[model samples]
Target: MGLLEYFRLAVRALKSNKMRTVLTMLGISIGVAVTILVVAIGEGATKSVADQVNGLGTNLLTVHQGPRQMKLTAATRNAPTQTQSTLTLDDAQMAATMFPDTIAAVAPQVRGNIQVRLNASNAQSTVLGTTPQYMIVNNVTMRSGRFFTMLEAQGNLKVCVIGNTTAGNLTGNPNADLTGQTISVNRDDYLIIGMLTPKGTGTGGPDPDDMVMMPVTTAMQRVLGAKYISDFSISCISPTMMVMAQQQVTALLRQRHHLMPPFPQNDDFVVNNQTDLLARSQNVTKTMTMLLTAVAVISLVVGGIGIMNVMLMSVKERTREIGIRKAIGARSRDILMQFLIEASIISVLGGIEGVILGVVSAVLLASFGGWNTIINPMALVLAVAASASVGIFFGIHPAQKAAAMNPIEALRYE
Candidate 1:
């Protein structure tokens, strides 16, 4: 039979058993839909994480005091933490002014407990003390006003920059219009020089925008009441310089801290290159996405099995029909084509329904979970192709069984 005739015959055969065809298609649809949604969600998660890491500027290395614990081998990888609080603000300043090859700029961070208040609104968030260069090092930009000045940082002026969340809460969620307003930190009013452009969620507990920024000297002396730094960042010049910068920063910090050679025992500092850290994060996300996709594939496999069962039963019930076709001048190839076309039609139809369901599911997930789920056109096309492949794989044995039917015995069946 020609292609047109085979399609017509397949359509008729499926239409006659509409309920069974619909049930089998439903199974395939559900499977495909689940797979598409899972993959889309995983993609969104990966994108969110990538964007968050990118917000930290590219090719950065940091040196800080290590965790005061022995459980983590990571703790020992950098210079060990000093139980005596050995990192001083002066050490960070020296490194900032001296290290210029691989390190572009450095900023020492000091933190202080402060109550941030604007008008009647109040929320307590840690205030950060760092230099004006911190804005560029951190890839930070102001949503309204600009970051603090170098002079301001050097003079230990009382100006502050804050994130969106902190601004909102202090403004009572009416308007985070804090650019010109003074935010009282530690019962001391500081001019809000600039409000940072909103940087969204992070694993660092809250968005960076939520915190307040002030001169490092002011935070250390006035707020923390100590002349020490909590941590520091060495923004590398390029991705290529990341490793060199890491090594250079390690040596520099060690030298500044007056640590002897091979000082593995409780040395006073830590150095981190964010390139390797970001790569590990990407790998983890990729692995999770693949794992979710693999789980979803099991459903597709089960749907294919369902298609096989349906087709096998179809061949058994239509034994006389197959025999009649064979007895006439119809070739086994024709019989095979008829069954194959029917199975493919079932799968393709299911695929269309699956695409609709998947998109809807992704939309709902994005809405409720604040995830950026996007099932791209390519993914939808691939799902349709996968469904068709599933049909062919499952329909093979049944099509063969029908094609091999014995005409004489089939005609004598009651």
Candidate 2:
């Protein structure tokens, strides 16, 4: 018989057991849907991180006082603490001045938490001490007013820039013109010179829009009362110069810190480039996605088993029909093809339904759950192909068993 005849026969055979066919199809569909959903969510999360990092400029490199380490113990309760950072504002200045050709800008930063009060209202927020170069190196833009001038930074003026979230809390309106208004921090009132444009949360970090910014000199002398800097951000002259900039900064800091040959596993300071960090983060996400996808694919295996069980039962129930067809000169290959075709039809149909369900689920998650989800076309194609393959692989044994049965024995079966 022709291929179309085989499909027609397969459909008729499946129609005879409507409920079982539906259940089998449902199983395959769920597997495909889950696999697609997991992969899409994973891809979305990676993309979100990449975008956040890129927003800070791909040519950026961050130099921290030291490599941060997580300490876990019965006493510390798994809290992470940093080793005393030897990096200071002087180190920041030296790096900028020493690598003028490779580095475009350097913004040293110190951070502290403080309670800010504006008249009767009060809010707790992070205060960052940074140079005017911070706005340029970190790609920060002011929504209103202007960034603190270098002269103001040098003079240690009592001035600050409020982020969007802090502005709303202190002034009761995010869009309020707080420029030139005063907010009390550490019992010292600071004039709000500018407001920063809203920047969303960082990758696995605090919201960037929920802090206050001030000149490094003012924050050290007037607010935080500290001498050491937490970190510094450096912008390279170009993307191609990021590696050279990183090398220069590392060598400069290592020599300045007086580290001898054979640098210890834990360096006094570290320099991180944005592109390398992005790649490392993406690799982690990709591994997680693969593991989750493997779990989802197990469901497909289960669905395939269901198809096999049903097909075996089908062969027994249709023994008399099979015997009559064999009696009429039907060949073993013909019977095998018919059964295989039936299984493929079921799985392929289920796969189509699954693709639709997965897309809708991804959209719903992004819209309502506030999650990032990106549906890849390759994922859809792979899911469908996997479903079809599962059907064929599991259906082969049952099809072969039926085809190998003796015609005389099958004909006489009840």
The candidate maximizing TM-score is 2
Against the unseen true structure, what C-alpha lDDT does each candidate score? Answer: 0.80, 0.87
lDDT of 2 by residue, 38-134 (tens): 9899999999978987898647999876643433347655656566677889999998998888999999999999999999999999999999899
Question: Candidate 1, which ten residues in sequence have the lowest lDDT sum?
Answer: 67-76
RMSD of each candidate relative to the true structure: 4.0, 3.9
Which segments of model 2 are wrong by more than 4 Å? 67-82
TM of each candidate vs. truth: 0.87, 0.92
Considering only N, C-alpha and C atoms within 3 Å, which residue pairs clash in candidate 2? none
